[model samples]
Target chain A: MPHATGKITARELIDLQSHLMLESTLVGQFNHFARESTDPQFGQLCQKLAHSRTDCLQRLAQHTNITPIQ
Target chain B: MYQDQVTDKNLCLAVINQLKWSATCLTGKILECEDEQLRQDYMQLLNRTFAEQKEAFDLAHQRGWYQPMMADQQMIGQVQSDTQKLMMEQQQSMSPMHQMAQYQGIQAPQGLNNYQQSFTNPNLQNQSIYVGGGQPYYSR
Candidate 1:
């Protein structure tokens, strides 16, 4: 079982949290750039990046068994 | 397993700093764009991203991984007033300054503080921060 013995190391916890924040921030940056872009294609590119980050965040959330506190 | 050997706090700081930089660069890009559809798309992405990042920040602060200095109300108020003044002067402002004026005021404590005390309370730790030994839960 993951986190077997129900004991998660500080490293793992921090790693997870850092990744969560990183992805969350990336999503915002991607969107911000997309908003400023003139090419619809650039917007599409940002869409892809944000979606990718969101998926990573969701997966991280699942692994940690906690909904991100907003 | 993490990719580096750095301390958790250090890693969090590094990651947060980089994220902040990325956001700054994007903000510049957003301000330079004239395309409506593209702007709308970026706006949506920023909205979603800002929300998610807020959560991450709250979590970090809760865990003692980060403690941003408390707000200086005088400076904050001045900045807010200046922004409002600018917004008033240029009702049809095409700059991101206008968009920034519309963003939420987060320098003041209110939303996240409501639940922050719980995370810091030692008694509440058993229910919030740590789960079954040291298993991290980051419960909201």
Candidate 2:
């Protein structure tokens, strides 16, 4: 059943949490790949991909309503 | 000889695969989700993933790192017909019991079933493992 209020269901929460983790890992990997790239254009492409992943991570994190623990 | 290191093409291919999987998963979740806002959010994410996947794929293709053969129309039509024939055969082969099971949603137990069992079983309660760290908000 769908949650009526602002709260999300457990399934949604789990999915969001997993997505956040996956996106975070991807962002890190892309950033590293960008840094290590020999080709300038490929480096730019990696950076762009990293930025996209960061945006996704932020969006997923926002929906989960959880502050990242330091 | 150069030392071993991950190539740009390999990284691009990995990213493309990840984005493709993300898009596929989001599509399935969007279809299953009944919540309007959640479905909208999933759709937006899926769109972004599709775009990112295309960008990565195009880059790889341009670099001649990921070239796929183009199938002719005849082969495509043959495959489509074959798939349709297979689907029809499968549908026709379904027994009454199979249909009844499907209607009642009786299916084989999945990993989630065992996971749920762990929570209910007293002996297994303490043994239940948690991944991704402890988060209070998500449990709410």
TM-score for all predictions?
0.34, 0.61
* lDDT (tens digit, per residue) of candidate 2 on B82-102: 999999888878877676555
Docking class of 1: incorrect
For B1-140, candidate 1 gives per-residue lDDT tens digits of 76455444444454356556545544654575444433454455456556645554664676687887887999899999999999977876665764554442322234544455455756554443323222334563
User: Best DockQ goes to which candidate?
Assistant: 2
DockQ for every prediction shown:
0.03, 0.16
User: In angstroms, how far off is B74's CA in candidate 2?
Assistant: 8.3
Q: What is the Cα-based lDDT of residue B58 in candidate 2?
A: 88
Give the worst 10-residue stretch by lDDT in candidate 1 chain B: B128-137
Please list all clashing residue pairs in model 2, or write none if there are none. none
Best by lDDT: 2
For candidate 2 chain B, the 10 contiguous residues with the lowest summed lDDT are B131-140
